[model samples]
Target: MFCYQCEQTAKGEGCKTMGVCGKKPEVAALQDLLIYALQGLALVAVEGRKAGVTDEEANLFTCEAVFSTLTNVDFDPERFVALIKRTVALRDSLAQKVKAAGGKTDFSEAAFTFQPAADLNGLVKQGEEVDLKNASDDNADIQSLKHILLFGIKGVAAYADHAKILGQEDDQVYAFIQESLVNLLRKDMGLQDWVGLVLKCGETNLRAMELLDAGNTGTYGHPVPTEVPLGAKAGKAILVSGHDLKDLEMLLKQTEGKGINIYTHGEMLPAHGYPELKKYSHFYGHYGTAWQNQQKEFAEFPGAILMTTNCIQKPQQSYQGNIFTTGLVGWPAVAHVDDKGCPSLLDKVKSAVGLGCSSQGKDFSAVIKKAQELPGFAADTDKGKVMVGFARNTVMGVADKVIQAVKDKNIRHFFLVAGCDGAKPGRNYYTEFVEKVPSDCVVLTLACGKFRFFDQNLGDIGGIPRLLDVGQCNDAYSAIQIAVALSQAFECGVNDLPLSMVLSWYEQKAVAILLTLLHLGIKDIRLGPSLPAFVTPNVLNVLVENFDIKPISTPDEDLKTILG
Candidate 1:
């Protein structure tokens, strides 16, 4: 498979045998083919757009296809095979339309004209030919930049898909996805060209995230500072994981008054801040920590589990039958709910919960029965509360207070310790980093990474919580907004403010967010647990020279460096 597109790639390098995320060789091969097909479609779409011909459906498909290839998003080889075939059909149709419009079409381009093998072996062969390592470029540095851009696109596609579901669409972001993919195939492009495109990918991702933020806040109302229950309630329940608010909303609506309580999990933990979702009395507190702990946590939970998007690890046999996947997530033999039919998901959940366990050992009632006996959010209050909902509006609403605190020396610095959480060893750096921060500094966090010390009471400074949960990773846009607002209030640039970003990345979404931070000229950011395997030393040099990017040291050392 030779995939090194995630933080936990095997041995800190490419996964040649299988993905650490439970993706088999066949699945990895198919995902590669799917990406190649999407690139081909992008080539045709980019050309067609030159002639003022475009298809929103094609754009949306490209985004969703890339998103599905992200780590733990889909492990179903059959699903990738189907998507590859559909991509070819779409690409060919677009090519024909371009030609009909009197626009030049590249009939010779491999991405545009290559056909997949009818069998799995053929598909693997096709994938092997298009692997990033085998690209025409012989320079590892250039190839690394290309892969960075490709990974960034995957993140952009994910946020774009989320936005599209809420009826929010941005043509410029879609157009950039097609343009960048076509550019990636250009052998004539130089390092500077690739570097420029990588930054542009970050710029486009910012737009994608902004669009998603709009969609989410527009649909569910802006997140408010509400105290979320960190415990579960006493009743039959279902845990909703992943980052899809729409799916959570639908599930909550369908399960209302049906005796099945809904609890947020993983990135969905932030859903409690949304007034529209919390309005449902049945929508209780969050359960578990992050995506990496699901295997153990899911087994211990006494309710059915529904994963709505990426970050799904392979289901353990213990709760395998009790889990359901919807949206773009997939695992072989796992029941999936198609978004086209909302009722399908509800029906599947109902059926799975009602079936109970028979002699076949498929029963989830025991899990649920045990879950109710466990103390959840009700027991968490003794630890005190951490404040969230400090998104752009929330922060800006208290801009004067923050500014005054800074002037009064009550708040000394701001640290954005955010990004994904993984099961890997060095992740505790985040917990220690947040723990060691001086009380005078405010910690801004987002995504599942916040789970590390979210329950820790960091206390508040002048009425502002020391640790601020800035929504999910998709809400990085909000973090940026808060930064920009603070900069304006201070009458200085973001870098000039007493701010530092110590981020941990595990997947493509982190890559995109990092790129966006770079695109905004934010410098001296610290990234860990380790640098991406795809980032060659030469590329790293470029980042260090231009952006002052640094790999993380110990929390004490890094804190001294940043505080100094």
Candidate 2:
């Protein structure tokens, strides 16, 4: 298993023995084979689209399957094996549609003709043959570009899947994904063309993110500023982690008035800002910081834990039974709440929180019951609160004041210090950088990386908070919009604005978001804790030459460079 799709591959190179994220060799092989199967499925889907046949179910499944393979999402080999079989079934189904439409169905690419093994052992063997390091490309630079595109597409699929759950659908995004999957096998493109396609992955990701923002803000109502407690309310409690809003809402609804308090964990911390989710009286406050610390955090938590989507670390034995996974996030022997036909765990109590029911069928009753059975917080604890929901809507609502403050020199500069978090070293740079951000400059943060300085008392300039908590990483669209709006107000390009992006990436979503930034022609951005292991030096050089992207250095040095 030679996989290096994330920032923390083994020793900053491909993971040969196993994944740095605790994935076993068998799971890794299955994931690789799953990708191989998805490629075939995508090839057939692309052909179907050319024949004017687009299956909505196929599009949604493709997105979900691609997203599940992302780092730390699903570590269940059984799940991957099932997904591989589904991919072949779907691929063959789509191929038949293409043939019926008088289109050519046969292809030379092995992915188009690949077959899955009958069992898990056989499947893992098949997967080992098509692992990422064994891609057909021998050119290091081209392979790097292909990896960038593939990983970026995974991120895009994540956002697309989220948006689809919220009743938002974009056919062109689906088309780009399917076509790009097949294009990975293309021999016609030059290295520069591959570079263009990689950037286009970023371009397509912008649309996927836009749809997610719309689905979130449009359904849940634009997030307004809300202060969420870091302390726990003594009672039955359910801690919801990961980034799925619908799961959080469903749990909130089912647990309502049952004496269960729903607390946000990790990326779900942003849920408090949304009006629809926050209105639940039982919806409580945040628990832990980010995904990497979950083993420690989940163990200490006094109630049931639900991981929704990605960044799920292996559950500590102390709290494994107390943890439940929903959506595509999975772990071996972990209780899952994904049965669509599963009965509603609680009686349907009326609530106004109708923010799209695309993901409503799952029964969170088991989680609620576990919460009821467990002894919740022994007593009330007050860790105070942090301000959130300063997304595009709220920030733009104060556009006049912010523009004036910038003009009046009260606001020195802007730093968008955001990205995913990991347990690796050097992450303290984000904490230190935010701490060292000059008082006059505002720091805008989104994603779990905001955990570094989220609770810091940075005060405010005039009425605006010095540190703005943009939504989750899913809301990168909001951050981009905020930058564009500020640039438009100042009548300059985004790069010309006083804003600088210093991001820390840990996974594919961050990769996709970075690609979006690059596609927009934004320059002079600093990215760290470390560059992706998959990005060869030549590929890095292209990024540096084309976009002035660079790695992060010391806080003082970076501050001096940006501020001076």
Candidate 3:
């Protein structure tokens, strides 16, 4: 098995033995087979669409299947096996429909018929044939472009799935996913075609993110500035991780008044800023840092834990039994909650931790016990407050102030130090980069990466906080909006503005966001901890020449270069 779709791929190359993310060879092979099947389904779907035979289910399934293959999302090989078989059936059914509609059904046999191996060995062989590198032409630049688009679609699917759960759907984005997958299968396509498709993937991801932004803000109101406690409370607690607000909301509703307090962890930290979620008195503060620290943090937490989405590391034996996964996230024995919100898991939490009973007549005791525990938020201290919820709306609300600050020279430059956070070396670059930003500059950040220096006192410039948390990685949309707005205000292009993007990528979501930035014609962006392994030297040269993309250097050196 070979895989290198993430930042932590083995030795910055393909993971041949097992995924550095703890995915075994069987699981890796199954994922490869699943992607191949999805491409097959896309081929049939694209042909059927030509004859006016469209399958929304096929399009949606393709998006979700790709998402499941992302790092840390799913580890159950059995699940992938089922998806592969189901996808093949779906593809065949679509092919029949295309023929019935009198569509031009002349396509490669591999696109029409994909028989997934019934055993692990057979699957591995099938996987080798369809490996990302092998599927492409021999040109390294073309192969890199194809991978950039494929990984971008995977990111789009994850964000689209989140919005879909809230009943938001865009037919065009789904159609684009199918269209792009089918194009990747074409051996006759040229370099220009691949480049155009990569940019289109970026443009489409922007729409996907817009759908998600609407779904989230519409469902849970716009996020507002709110303080989140970094400590835990006494009595039984349930630590929730990942980026699913809907799951967190349902859990909050179910456990409300049941004596079990809910605490946010990882990307779920942004949930505290939502007005509807914060209204729950039982809702407490955050428990730990980013996803990379979950093993140690989950083990130390005194209550149950729920991972609502990706970024879940393999659970340790210490907390495996108490950990539950929901949505697209899956593990071998960990409990899962479905879309309806699993209430049994709440009961399991109650039974496992004994949160159902307390001293002061069960009601007052929970609250009193929590109050007695170490205060998660020390109201008297400055460390308790860190500004967040500065998405497009909040930032645009103060556009005049920001513009005036720039004119007044109170704000010199804007640095977007954003993207995923990992435990790998050189990650400390982000912390140091944020720390070294001049006081006259504004730092805008998003995703779990903000946790690096979020608590630091960067101060404010002309009433605007120096460090602004811009929602999750998908909120790269928000960052783009802010940049466009600033550009309009300054009467110049985004690149001409006094702004720089210092990004750190760890997963496919970052892949999609990078494409979006490139699609918008933003240049001179710095990306690290290191370049993707799949990006060959020739491809890297193309990016440097065309888009001015650069790997990161030391913070001091990069700062001098950017500032100059």
Candidate 4:
């Protein structure tokens, strides 16, 4: 499919035969089709805006369609085909409505269609399917810019979709997603326009992140520092992966006192920091590292694995029967959780109960008893000397301090190092980058990507640690808020400030954040472990010339480049 949009792309190049994430040819083709369908849907919504469409429906569609295309979000061809059909129907219906009103409508031009790999000659001889390679775009740079916008929109769609699922929805974020996608369909779009829209994607995503932060912090409490145990107690256990707090909360509630111990996996590890979630005695600790390790991690664990979102990998048959997927995450054989987030997991947990060896004998009463003794810390509960509200508000409060820090050289430069994590080896560049940051500099990070360096003991500059993890990747919103606050405090534009963004992208969400940075006129940002394959040379030119977006190199070299 020529998909190199993720860190795990084969050989650091495009995944031609199959996705390194274990996505098959048909699945990848369907995903592309689904994305195209969503683009069409975005076009409809954009036109609907002129016809006075309510922002809610338009936004909802934007979020869902985008969510469907995220890495590992949907692998089930059945589910994907259904979504494509739904999107096509939505576009068609909207077009009809517009037609009746005598309004003109346009859709994104279709790039390519899917066919069996065996139908192709050379690639077929190599056992690979020829997929959509964006061949229709005659201009290399415009293709790259289009890819940046397209990928960014996909990323925003993911975060907004998750927020919507939590019973929290924002109309503005959705509208921006629709508006952003539709704007890219124009053939004559300028580089400046693309760059501006990219930054706006970041800004809107920041708002989406803020909305989710509020939804999460308001629903749960602000995340606090909490130590979670690694292994599970003696009982039936269910490991929940991906990044959906509401799903975790509901699962914790349903499985609570039912003798099912719930463990957090992958990005869900941070959920333990949230107040409302950790209150459940049955909630266990984190399982493994990033989502890439899932196939092996899930093998040894004894319980049901519930995938609530992205970063899904092809599963081994050993645990295949026990895995359950909900929301946008899907796989061929895994049982699908229905709309209510209910899957037949409990029965599987029950059946596997007496089959596997227990962490202890019988019940986990002792572990649960021990957990209650530990106290939790969050925004409302931190009570620590270090300030926690460094989001937009706290940043404003300390605006003078940040400006003063820069003035006094206590903070040499500000670096926004953020994005998702994957199986790529060079991703260690992030660990080294954090380690190599000058003592006078402050490092701001977000997303599961930050886990690479978050645990490091980077001592404080004054009272603030040199490396400050703002929160999850979606909390890049918090990072942006802090940046804007600093810029205002310094009485300069954000791009003019002595701040540099060195981002490590693994998924589409990073795409949106990069776009947002560009939209805000932020420049000289470094992005790596690798540039996206979807980006054409022309697109790269647009980014390089306008935003100064560059690939990462040695931490020493990059540090010198940014500092010197």
Candidate 5:
């Protein structure tokens, strides 16, 4: 098994035996094979589109299927097998439809004509046969670019899937996914072509994030400044993790007034800022820091836990039964709540794919039931409160004030400290960097990376808070919009503005966001805790030469360089 798609892959290279994320070799093989199956499906879907046949089901499934292959999302071999079969079934079915529509279907490419074995062992063998780690003959630079495109597509799929769940989608995004998948298989594409494709993936991710922002704001109302308690109220509780807002809202609806208080964990901490979600009286404060710290946090929580999307860890035996995964997240033998039944927010994900979206979602009654059975927060404990709800709308509402502060030099600079967080030691750089930001500067933060310093008392600049919580990684569009607006107000490019983006990346979604930044001609961005293993030195050199991207140095050094 060769996997190096995340920041924490083994020894700064591929994981040959197992994933550092606790993914087993078998599951890794299945995930690779799932991508292979999607290639076949995408190959046909591209042809189908040419024939004037656009299937919403096929489009949504492609997103879901591609999303499932992302790191730390699904770790169950059984789940991958089911997804692989589903993909192949959809592929063949689409091929027939294309044929009926007078599109050519006969192709000898292995991806087109390949058949899956009936058993798990046989499927793993098929996966090994198609594993590109050993099978590809492309130059290292081309392979690196393809990896970038593929990983970026996964991020696009994830954001697109979330948007669709909330009734927002664009067919153009689906078309890009199929076209990119087909292009990745092209042997004739050179480094320059692949580079353009990678940038295009970034542009596509921008749209996906835009759709997600629309879905989130349109349904939930633009986030208004709200203060969430860090304390735990005495009652049965459920800690919702991952980045899906609809999942948390559905659970909030189902668990309403059942003597329960809902809490957010990791990226879900930003949910408190959204007007529609925080309206529920039962919805309470945030519980944990970031995704990497889940095992400890989940263990201490007395009530049930629900993981909505990605950023899940192996379940500890103590909290395994209390933890449940819904939507695309999975772990072996851990109880999973499928997108079915009522009092659920996710069955709608399935219905949204084919059947029209309805109010019904994934059943959370079981999760609520588990909460009732456990001891929740033995007593009321006030851990203090933290401010959220500083997304684009809220920040822009005070944009005139912001512009004035910058003009008056009351705010000397703007720093965007955002992106995914990880368990590695170097991650502490983010915490220290935010702590050291001058009083005259403001830090715009988002995603789980903010957890490193979210609770810090950074004080305020004039009437403006020094720290702004922009929302999740899925809300990159909001962050981008903020930069764009600031750029426009200042009549200068984003890079020319006094704002610097210092980002921490851990997964494919981060890759997509980075590509989006590069695509926009944003330069001199500081990126760390570590660089991606998939990027070869030549590819890295190209990135550095073109984008002025730098691996992070000490926070003090970076701050001096940027502020000077």
Candidate 6:
């Protein structure tokens, strides 16, 4: 199997044996096949638009198919196998309807079909043979462009998938996903077609992101300034990871006042800032940092680990029985908490760890006492003073300040250091990069990536913290807002502003954001700890010439280069 849609791909190239993320060969092939089937389904939807397919049905199809392939989200082969067959059936039925209505169809000769479990191994062998046979494309550059577009859609699907789980689905976004996927599969397409899809992916993702922001903010109330604790209490605790706010919300509601202490883990760290979630009296602080640290972090914690979303490396057998997965996240042997939709992690919490009963009559004054000491300053409470909502809207509101700052040299350069976090040691570059940034410059960060330097006392500039945590990774929307606002204020393009995006990516969400930046023609983005293994040299050149994308170097050197 060949896969390279992430930073840690085998030896900085495609993973031929097994994924560094611990994805087995069969799973990798299924994911690729899943993506291929989704493209066919998209073609069906495009035709179904003329026939009678509802936008809601199309949206669900795109979101689920895309989210299923995101890094670490699903590993249950049985579920995926069933999903592929179902998607293929949907695609074929849509195609037949289109043909009957005399509408155009792009169903290629390479139409995907389902293989029963009994024939799964045979199909896998066929896929391997096809990979070997089609190893050489007629034009290498064309293949590279297709890779960029396909990977970008994979990223877009991830964000769209997350939004769907929250009951926020957009039909246009699904149409774009379908259209873009169909484009990648078209062997007759040219560079312009691929390039257009890339930019549209960015614009549509901006909309997809807005839907999620509304869903999250509307459901959880706007995230307020709140400090989260680092240490877990000496009791039965349930460590929750991944990026699903809704699932987290449900879990919090079910476990409330039941003596079980809910601790946020990994991507869920930002949940503490959401007012609705933070109000939970039993809700505790963050358990660990980022998805990559889970194995070691979950080992000693005295409770079950509920992974709500992706970036979960395969679990060790030590805690397999205690670990629980909900929603789309799955593993081989891990007990899945929810089969239909929302399952009772509440009951599981009680059964697995004794309902956190050790402190039955213990006083809770000490936990509250510890939290009062460290209140974090996120987006909510800083309104007017620091301009709380930097999401494209609020940034544009202060457009003049940014332009004036650049002109007066109060802020000579803008640094956007954002993306997902991982366990690799080279991640230190993010910390050093923030440290080495010039004093006259401002640092904008989002997502768990900011944890690298969020604690540093960078002081303030113009009453704004030099190191600004905009929001979560979805909050990269804020960083883009700041850039575009500055551009409009200066009456020049966003790239013309003195801004450099230094991004570190780990999962598909990062992939979507990077594509969005590329789509907007944002240039000179320095990405690392390494470039994606999936990108070929030809595709890299397209990005370099058009967008001037660069891989991260030493913090000091990159600082001089970006700020010069």
Q: TM-scores of all models?
A: 0.92, 0.96, 0.91, 0.79, 0.97, 0.84
Q: How far out, in Å, is residue 102 in model 5?
A: 0.9
Ranking by TM-score: 5, 2, 1, 3, 6, 4
lDDT of 5: 0.87
**Model 1: how far residue 140 lies from native, Å:** 1.1
C-alpha lDDT of all candidate models, in order: 0.83, 0.87, 0.81, 0.68, 0.87, 0.69
Model 1 global lDDT (CA atoms, 0 to 1): 0.83
Quote the positional error of residue 315 for candidate 6 in Å: 1.1
**What would the per-residue lDDT of candidate 2 be over residues 90-159, giving only the tens digit for each residue?**
7887788889997768887898898877778899889888888676587888888888899999999999
Quote the RMSD, in angstroms, for model 5.
2.5
Model 1 RMSD in angstroms: 5.8
lDDT of 1 by residue, 1-564 (tens): 689999999899889887888989888878888888888899888878889888766887788788889888999877777778778877877788998998878656688777889977889788877776666378788889989998999999899988887878899999988888887877788999899999999999999998999999999999888787666666677898999898788777666666667888889888888889979998877778899999999988777788888989889898887788877889888877554323332253333221111122122333344335443233222323345676778778888999999999899899999999998899999999999999899999999988899989888998888988888999999999989988988889999998999999999999999999999999999999989999999999999999999999999999998888
Q: Model 5, 1-564: lDDT tens per residue?
A: 998899998888888898899999888888888888888888899989889988787898889888998989999888777777777777887888999999879866688877889989999988887675965645988998998999999999999999998989999999999889888788998889999999999999999999999999999999988898898999889999998888888888888779999999998988898888878999989897889888999999999999999999999998999999988899987878766534222333333333223346677888989999998988899887888888888889999999999999899999999999998779999999998888899999998899999998888987799998988997878888988999999999898999999999999999999999999999999999988988989999999999999999998999999988
TM-score of 2: 0.96
Expressed as tens digits, the lDDT of each residue in 7-46 for candidate 3 is 9888898898888899998888778778888888888887
Candidate 1: clashing pairs of residues: 230-377, 231-376, 231-377, 302-367, 302-368, 357-363
Q: How does candidate 1 fare on TM-score?
A: 0.92
After superposition, candidate 4 runs with Cα above 4 Å error = 11-13, 39-43, 54-59, 99-102, 105-131, 179-200, 228-236, 341-414, 438-441, 461-463, 490-499
Q: In model 5, where do residues sit more than 4 Å from their true spots?
A: 341-359
Worst lDDT run of 10 residues, candidate 5, spans 343-352
Q: Give the higher-lDDT candidate: 3 or 5.
A: 5
Q: What lDDT tens digits, residue by residue, belong to model 4 across residues 1-564?
A: 667667667887678788887787777776766665566677766667677654354457557767777777887766655555555555666777766665567432651122223222322222222134753356666666666667777788787776766556777787887776656557777766766676677778777766777787788876665666654466666788888887677777666766667877777776777778878987766666677778898887667778878888888998887777776677877776544322232332233211112112123232334233322211121212221223444445556776777788888888888788878778899888988888888887767777677656678776665766566677777677787777777788888888888888888887777766676677888888888877766677767897788999899999998889
